[model samples]
Every structure is written in C-alpha cells, then in structure tokens.
Target: MNHDRSNRVCPVENAGGLDNGIRKFLQNPRKILSPYVKAGMTVLDVGCGPGVFSIEMARMVGTSGRVIAADLQDGMLEIVKRKIKGTEAEKIVGIHKCLSDRIGVTDKVDFALAFYMVHEVPDQASFFKELHEILKPNGSLLIVEPKVHVSRSGFEEMLKLVRSLHFEVAERPKVFFSRVAMLRRLA
Candidate 1:
C-alpha cells in the first residue's frame, strides 16, 4: 500500500494507505468473488482509484496473469503506476485511462472489481452492461459500493441490472461503511 496523498480530488482517503499486512487481512476479496480468481487469471480493476488492491491482485494472479489498473484520473493512476513501476511485477500489471464506462476488457480476463467506487459512477446501468459484455463466460464482477454515501435504491438497481444480465450474486462480504455486491456472469 504505497500512495502519496497529494491528489485529493475525491476527498476519499487514499485507497492505497492500507499496508501490506493489512491488505492481506482484507484478501477476503477472493471469498467475495471466490473460485473465480486463481493463480493464472486475467483481471480488471476498474475505478482502481490508486491501485491498492490492484497491487494485491497482481500478487494473487502471480506471473502468469495480467492485471489492468484503470481509472478516470491520470494523476491518481500515475501515482499508482510510479509506485509499482520498474520491477518484475510491472510486467504483470498495466494501466489505462477510460472514462466512458466502456471497460475495454478483452475475452481473456476472468475477474473484474469495482471497489467502493461504483455508486459514484455517472451511469450504473451503462457500466454494468459494459462489465457484462467484457467478461469472459462465467467471469465475475465484484462491486463494492459504500452503503452509507450510496443509496440503497441504487444498490438494488444494480442487483436488478446484474440479474437481468444473467449475473448472479456469488458472494457478499460484510464491508464496513460499504456493501459488497458480487455477481458472476453465467457460464
């Protein structure tokens, strides 16, 4: 968890402040998405804010799989990019700037995560559709949105959206101040 707090556009505490050990403690993301992620599976971290979990995911996917760290802010992405630049791990990770909620994930990725950032999205329906399209067969999309700042109705709306797309709620972790919405694309 390496991050510089200089960029404060979101007012949300830097997502990368949780230390390495602490990150391991929160590795329950696997439990949330479960068997979908293995040692060699391509992953997408949408709205990767500052690459906190993206770093952890790189370790999970190991040397075989690739993790694409994407966000709308180049400033924040640059911070995370520099934090992990020039290393063996760099080969397994990539960064991108996409604001259209298009996702841009290819058929290779097995997992996608939007950690505590989905509700802030300008259009939930559009984002969910894009996620459903990019994921491979049976691919998983784990959405963790703040239950406090975000509306309950919106979460329900997403639930409906995912279900309509044939995605099921695979798991839901008990996240503090937030609710985890894990959905899996039908195989």
Candidate 2:
C-alpha cells in the first residue's frame, strides 16, 4: 500500500490509444508474452489499460488459466469487461479495480506483466515489494517501460530497487520502444 497519488496515472479518456491496431503492430502482446505465459498459469496484467494486454493474455493462458486485469481506474476495467463479454475470454479474464495505495490482489500469480506503466508509479520500492509478495516463489515479473518516457538511468534505478527486494534478473528482453526486464522472485 505504498502508492502515492503524485504520479500521473493514464486517464480513461485516452484508453483508445492504448489498445489500437497501431500499438498492436508496434508492441504485439502475444510475441512479448508467449515465452512467459502458458496454459493453466495464473497471470496478472498490471495497469491493464483498456484490456489490451489482458485480452491477449487470456488467450495465452487458455480456459484453465486466469488473467487478472488490474487497474486503478474503473473506466479502464469497464472497457476490459466490455471487450471480453460474450467471448471465451470472458471466463478467463478477471477485472479488478486496484486501490490507489496498492494492487489489492490476494492471489499469487505465476507471471505478471507491467507494460509501459511502471513510470506511473510514485513509490516504486513499495510497489516492487508488493509485487514480490504476490508472486509465487520463482515466479516471473516482466517490467516494460516506454523508452520515450523512462531514461536509461531511470530504468537502472528501478533495477536497483528490484534487486534489493530479492528479485533476480531473469533476462533483458528486446521490445519495441521499450526498456524491458524479466525478474524472478527468490525462493
């Protein structure tokens, strides 16, 4: 619960830009997540704007798996609900409204995706700590920040905090216009 309100959270009004074809072409969710996600695995899409990554995650996880689409804005969650309605993904994707101070999810996830949204977090230490708590032992968290927003030094600072929290660097994946880090929770 260490979230601070000073950070800029994406408004629901601009959500359309987050889930469009142009973005999909540049940052295809399936290609970015296929290595980490699997059928029957429980996953999390943090700051899932308009369910872009959440919808794709639902497909990757299959019917036996679950994709938690957690966001602070109810408008964003509503968009996710609408996108999944009447689809097979409806049963696989769960929408959760995150608390201002924390993620507020109780279930431990096998994998978590933080795409282009970590820069929006005000208290990253607390944020990463909470993520550490919710990830199963050896579980992976893929953190992707927009290169346009987060500088190399800023991303290094984030990695320092991530390491201090007992998460090890799994790898650095190449992503279009993004600085990516795959972290694994220690057992």
Candidate 3:
C-alpha cells in the first residue's frame, strides 16, 4: 500500500479538494450514469476519501436514496462535510471508516465507486472479490485512477482478473475520462 497519506475523518459534512465547480465538470458522467442509478437505490462510494463523489451522487440520486460513503480516513469525511454545507445532502450521506477488504456496509448497493482508489490497495484480488460479493445483481463498479500512476497494460491485466469474477467493462472512456474503466457486475 504505497498510498501513504493522512487518513482520518468523520462524514458529518462535505469534503473539499473536489468542489462543486470542479464537480460540474463531471456532468458527462452523471448523464452516462443516470440509467444505472435511480431514486431509492442504495449506493456505495468505496475509498470515499473527502466524499466529493458521494455528495455529488447523493444529489443525483435524490432524497429517497441512500449513499454510504466509506473510507479508511475520517478526516476526509470531514472535508466532505465542509464542501456540501447545508443542504439535503446532510441526511442522505452515511459514513463508515474501515480498512477491511469487505467494506462493512450493510446496504445492498446498486452501484459502487472506486475512484482513484484501486491501485492503492495492498490486496487487489481480495478487494475486488469483496466488492463483487457486496454488489446487488445487475449492479455496477466503476474504478478511476491516475493514468500516470500505473501503466495501461498493467491496469488491463488487473481488469482481466476482475473479469474472471464476472465483471465486464461496459465502457472504456479514454484516459481523460477520469482514467477509468466502468465495469458492470454480470454475475
């Protein structure tokens, strides 16, 4: 785990470093992702440091939905709190701090996000296996990483192993596309 950084937080508010202005730049993803996420659905943001993505997704999913923003850091969750200020977001977001491979979330999530996080894991297979089991059937997992951090070939190899567990890349949206490959849970 070369992800050496301070990891402490509480998800009582918005986390910055990903403000709403920058978040607006992510509008395209919301359009592409709306079909997979719906009101009343449960969503999980894995490695949800600072919880920017979770806050955004909370707005998109509406009041009836739930968002579990799990991270190994509580300070990041506090950052998320400062970002969203006062809004409907305060209630929709839940925070969990855990470093275990099986994220201690009880919700049957319709979607899971591993934004800029998978590469930092000390155990990739164990992480994915746990994610695979937690997802509801027809759920989806999207992973985003810096294109500079890992070679494209190395990423593809890891993705291949995940595919064996029944995940298939539904979209490959270029490096600029958050350097991510969105995978749909098929099994």
Candidate 4:
C-alpha cells in the first residue's frame, strides 16, 4: 500500500488537449478492446482518465453490463460523470474515486483494462494482487503502457510481477507506440 505519488500524471494534464482527437485516433477503445470484451460483462477501467475508454466500454457492454471507471483523482471522475450525463451509457457506467493502495471495487469483474496507467502506480505488486481479487476466475486483464515512458526492461519487470501473482499471459496485442500484454487469472 505504498502511496508514492511522484510520477503520477496530474489531474490537469488528464484534461489536456492531447487527450482529444489525437489520443482517441491512436487509442480507439472499440478497436483495441473489442477482441477481449463481450456483451453483458462487468469491466473495470483502472486509471480511467476522462471517460475516454470508459464511455466506449459502457457501450460495448450494453445495457446489461457495467463499466467501473476508477481513478485516483476526483477531478478525473468528475469529467467522466459529466461526459455520461445524459446518455444511455450513463446508466451502465459507475464513476469511482480510487486510492493508491485499493481500487475500492467489490464486485467481481469479467474484464479489466489498465491503459498507460500502471506505470503511475506506486506499488505494482499490491495493485496486481487487488486486481486478482476483484477479477472473476479466468477473467482477463489488459495492461498497456506507453513505450516512451516504460522501457522494455521496466515492462518485463512488471510482467514478472504479474506472473508471480499467477496471471498467465494470454496474448500480446500490438498497440501503436505501446507495450501491451493481456493476462488471465488462473482458475
């Protein structure tokens, strides 16, 4: 439960102009996640910075499913709350303010997405352990980090931690300028 917050991206930067069209073009939620997500599945979007992917996930999950959009910053969650104000997605998406140690999610999830945000976490091992607990048996977690920020060695270290937690690598999807790994919890 280490709370080292030095490298975390500030809430203000979470709303930067770069998060608009350019970011969406490169990291389209539907294109990147369609392979793993299905209808009626509860999904968790960790470090969901402005509802960019959360909104799309809500749609992908449809009316029967749920998308927990969790972030450390209240401002970030506020942005997501505003984005889904009057849409159908609003009914399925839940905005959660998470802490550095705990994600604060009790419901078991079918899938989880951690995009470009794992590097910002202070304690990787503890984070993964919490994820393992919340995810259903055989559930999948997709972790994508910025190549520019996380080096090959760093990413490998992260993978080693995940493996130690008994998560097996299911696939390595090619994401533009990102190092990606999809892992599944052991039953």
Candidate 5:
C-alpha cells in the first residue's frame, strides 16, 4: 500500500492503544530487546509511541544508560513524560521531539529501535542513512514493522536500501506479528 508519511504517522489521540497490557504480552519489550540492550548502553527508540518500549528499555539499560524516546508528536512525548515521572525510569529515559523526516538526536547510541514506525518515514533511504550516522560504529539497529501494514516485498525493498547504506543484516529475530530486521552499522 502506498502511504503518505503524514497519514501513516500514528495520531496522538490513538496513542493510548499503542501501549497496553496486550501489546506488552505480544511484544514483550524485555524479551525482544534484552540481547542487544546492555547495562550502561545508550539506546534510541525512534518513533517511540507512549514509550511502551522506552520504559522497559530504561530498566534494561539501568541507571547509567539512557533511553531516548524520540517521537514526532508532542502529545505522545507528553504521554511518555507522564509515564516516567516519579519512577526510576524518569532518570534513565529522555523524551525527544523529532521532525517529519529527521530523528535529530546528536548523541551516538549503542543501539536503536524503530518499532512499527519505519514505514511511516517519507524517505526510507534517507531515514536509514541518518540512522547509520547516529549509530556508534558496530552499533545495532532493530527495526520492527507491523506485518499487516508492510508487505513482504516492501520490507525486502527497505532491506535493500538499508544494506546499500552500509548496514549489514545482523539477524531477523521473531516478534509475534512483526517483520523484524536486526542490522549492524558497518565500521
């Protein structure tokens, strides 16, 4: 399906649905992220919706690490802000506002996650390129797109673009209902 980036961006009104008990059961942030995220490792959650993954990622990364919950919508970031307040995660997770076509984070991260959100990018190649630049050398990027919205061919097309930009396929880990691609930045 041809999707305009703006239309594909999840509206903040529906942000409540993005994080809930069922999603936790299916996506299980820790299980999907544990292998790549380590204590004191800085990570980025690109398009983090309501911080479902960000909060848990903070716990995984511990006090020394940082989880940047980057999103385009201020309301969504506000939701994350509220969720982390007065919690240990508040110290570890930082909410960042992104532009339509840019993540805009200056810090190099040990790992990055684009969960159910890459297809919404207006320019996939540029998106991957920026992701490549922001990642530390040999850093890992885990991209999980919803299978229902992204076709197999479309996902492969993205992979081709990602590889062309100096990212190698690290592994394809299984997530309940997602097309998963784990990539490593080539030094």
Candidate 6:
C-alpha cells in the first residue's frame, strides 16, 4: 500500500491515544516488554510519540542504561520532554527528532520498539536497514502494529521486507488488538 508521509497521524492525536488511560491498561508497557527488556540494557523507542512506553522503558533500563525516544515531529518530542521532566525517567530518556528517511541514531541498542508506527514510514526498506545497522549483536527489535489499521496482507508484506534485510523472526507475541513480531539480526 502506498502512503504519503503527510497522511501520518498528527502529533496531537497521537499523544491522546498514546497516553490514554484505557489504552495504557490495554497496552501496558511493562507487561508487553518484560521478557525482552532488562536493567542496564540500552533501548530505542522508535516512533516514541508522547513517551508512554519510553518512560516505562527508561524505568526498566534504570540509571545504567539509556532510552532514546525518537519521533519525526518536534511537537511529539516536546511532549515527551514535558512528560519526563522532573521525573527519574528524565535522566535516562533522550528525546530525538528524526527525519522521514533517517532515524539518525548513533548508539547501538540492545532492544528497539517500533510500536504502531512502521506502516507510517515512507521508506520501510531504508528504515529497516538503518535499524539493522544500529542493533547490537544479539539485539532484538519488537514491532507491533494495530490490527485494525493494518491488514494481514500488509503486515505480511512488512515481514517480508524485514526478512529481506536478513532479520530472523524470533517470536510472534500476542498483543491485544495488534500484530506483534520479535526479530533478531542474522549474524
């Protein structure tokens, strides 16, 4: 399916959904990521939006680790910055503004979360390639897309693109109302 970057959801709407009380209950960051995340493990929260998961992941990573919260909209990053201010999570979480075609993350990460945002990317191939480059050896990436928004065929197409970059499917976790996949870089 062809998508225009301009058609991406606005930052304001994204913030509402990301931090909604019911949504958090349905998509608890801790429960969804506990198996893969550990203390002192550097993580990347791709398409971090208002930092709901970023803050939770920052707490999980503790002071020794870092969470890079990247989003294409400055407004979204600003919301993340505001949400984390005056909290312990602020110390570990870094807000980054990324471009449409490049993530521009320099640090290698142990884990990356691309939650409900991959379908919005204008260039999936380049995005996955860059992600592959920054992942540490044995690192994992978890991708979750809303089943309501993404059809099975479209999600399968994305999996094909990920495999083309030599990423191996490690697991398919069940997420409420979402299609989830855990992938590792092929050594």
For lDDT, the strongest prediction is: 5
Full-model lDDT, candidate 5: 0.90
The number of clashing residue pairs in each candidate reads 0, 0, 16, 0, 0, 0
Q: How do all the candidates rank in terms of lDDT, highest first?
A: 5, 2, 6, 4, 3, 1
lDDT string, candidate 1, 63-124, tens digits: 99888888877777786788788876698888877765466665457889888667556666
Give per-residue CA lDDT, model 5, range 1-187, as digits (tens).
2332243788898987888899889889999999999999999999998899999999999999999999999999999999999999999998899999888999999999999898888878778889999999999999998888887888888888889999999899999989999999997
Taking every candidate in turn, the Cα RMSD to the unseen true structure, in Å, is: 5.8, 2.4, 4.3, 2.3, 1.8, 1.9
Say what the RMSD of model 4 is. 2.3
- Give stretches of model 5 more than 4 Å off: 1-7
Please, what are the lDDT tens digits per residue for candidate 2 over residues 1-187?
A: 2122235888999998887899999898899999999999999999998988999989999999999999999999999999899999999999998887799899999999999788888778888889998899999999998877787888887898899999999899999988999999996
TM-score of each: 0.80, 0.95, 0.81, 0.94, 0.96, 0.95
Compose the digit string of candidate 4's lDDT tens values, residues 1-187. Answer: 2222345665546476536888889878799999988899999999998878899999999999999999988888888898899999999999888987788899999999998788888888889999999999999999998887888888888898899998999999999999999999986
lDDT on C-alpha atoms for all candidate structures: 0.71, 0.89, 0.73, 0.88, 0.90, 0.88
- By lDDT, the better pick of 2 and 4 is 2
Q: How close is candidate 4 to the true structure, as a TM-score?
A: 0.94
**Model 3 C-alpha lDDT per residue in residues 50-89, reported as the tens digit of each score:** 7657877898788899888888766776676666668788
In model 5, which residue pairs have backbone atoms overlapping below 3 Å? Answer: none
